[model samples]
Target: MLTNACAIIATAASAQIIAGRDASADDWPGMASLQTVLGHSLFHECGATMISPEWALTAAHCVEDARIETGGRAYQYARADDGSLVRFGVLSVAIGAADLRRRGAGTVFPLSAVIVHPAYKPEKPEAGNDIALLRLESPWEGPVALVDGLTVVPREDNLDGPPLVVAGYGRTEEDGPGEEAFSQTGRQLSAPKMRLQEGYVPFVETEACRQQIDSLVARYGLSDIYTDVAISPDSQICAGAGTTDSCQGDSGGPLVYRDYADPPVQVGIVSWGLGCGRPESPGIYTRVAAYADWISGVTGLQIAAPQP
Candidate 1:
């Protein structure tokens, strides 16, 4: 059943990073670059977080076409109708490294399986339920390990909580000049940093978030693009400050809340937004806490309770 009440929202663009800083080598150990290999080139499509050695979490839209057949043993590949294999791209994960180009800095694992949430609607991303899990072909064998026992909790409505960090290899500019801007073909381009980029964005209270987005819709005359409820507070989290926000290429990445003296915990997954770093149009993320049980059910891993 569709758990979220609001399945339709406005301008559901994939998220990325805008005006973010470069991440250090030691930061975000669980950060995984979702890559696709075509011929001799490897392209970074989106971001993911390695939850376990063999399991990683990302957005459903990232691998929406990936299918696992009956008996859970065969992969479905595009065909030419002539019963011949159509060469395309292979999905994989590059983990343990902040910079993707550095050889030996990380290990790349081919995807064994991809499971998208049943409730997810590719056409209506703003309606919530945009999460997915990727099973690694094999367990990671690197020193950059993942921290287990990370669970999500409902964030308070107020802004008293600390800022969250969003990291990815997405474009650094949008609607502006230079390489990071969109192409004339209207495709969102990536002028990602050689290393992972990160930005600190404050949480936008649910009610305030909705109002601000509504104002944005009115100002830009986006009534045709967005519905009455642009953000579903129950299944989505809003976070952005100034020009620092998630935009294209950052989808499926983690929005981690790190408190002092405590291990960092991922609270959200980059889902959609109105525009790149627009005022009042905060980036929306899939609330991880809302689907905790679903994730556990799909991956068959017993998620630990959050510490008090």
Candidate 2:
């Protein structure tokens, strides 16, 4: 996600940590985090999902602030007190395993490079195609994708009522977002509550999603920013309700759904939305299934292991 109307008319960016219950740090072992570290200190940035041993998927905007390197070289994005983007030496991408809030719970990887979709338009986030791929320095010996069968729930205007799980190392409190969501401890902060959170939000119909966003657009007289905040149904999926939703840091994370006995398959990537956990406006995720062929063509790796 980009940010919101100010940045782009009626357009929403990746995410922000917001009101949502805490999920087990252990769930979704494939979950990964992109961070900037200083000495032994780590600052949480964006979330990513491991799609293969050496390849992963995330939102294009998530990597916009990052610099691409020649190799799996290290680069650091140091945040200044003024919140200005500061660079330290060559750009290095640090990847963490599961359990972000927990120290030593996840392992760090050297990111080789990141590839953003050429079709992605930052000025028009709602136009669709908000996906990206990352290549690690080496083959990852960690959790990979579940490809036993068709795990993704297709991007349809009417998915009816399907169960969905969204997990991220994003904001724990809806009101507290951005830098405030992170602790100020000089040392590593113990955020057991903020480690990794998951929410069980029902998949919403595309039309219903459009209606909610449109109502807001009409109510607030945002016709100037956007005439159709309806969001693209083929490129995005909607979820959450009332207080349950995915927030800022949740961007580029995974939206998984189980089909049967096989492990849960990722269907969506945290993309954008109006706000965190708004009653009518739910979180929107990039439909992973819709870009299967694109992902395969970009990364040259199967979305998952060959089905049995």
lDDT of 1 by residue, 77-160 (tens): 444657565545677787865666653533777788998889987545666788888998778765332322334344554333
Best by TM-score: 1
lDDT of candidate 1 vs native?
Answer: 0.67
TM-scores for all predictions: 0.79, 0.78
Instruction: Give residue 159's lDDT in candidate 2 (0 to 100).
Output: 51
Taking the candidates one at a time, how many backbone clashes does each contain? Answer: 4, 15
Q: Over 4 Å off in model 1, which ranges?
A: 1-15, 68-87, 142-160, 176-191, 227-230, 306-308
Off by over 4 Å in 2: 5-19, 38-40, 70-98, 101-106, 147-158, 177-193, 226-230, 303-308
Residue-level lDDT tens digits of model 2 in 1-308: 34453543212244544554555544575677766555645665667877777787888767755665455464645447686878754322233444443334235566777777888864444556877888877777766654212234333434557667777766655545444233333445322134567777787877888888777667766677664343676667887764777766777878877544656678788877766666787777787777877877877754443435
**CA-lDDT, candidates in order:** 0.67, 0.62
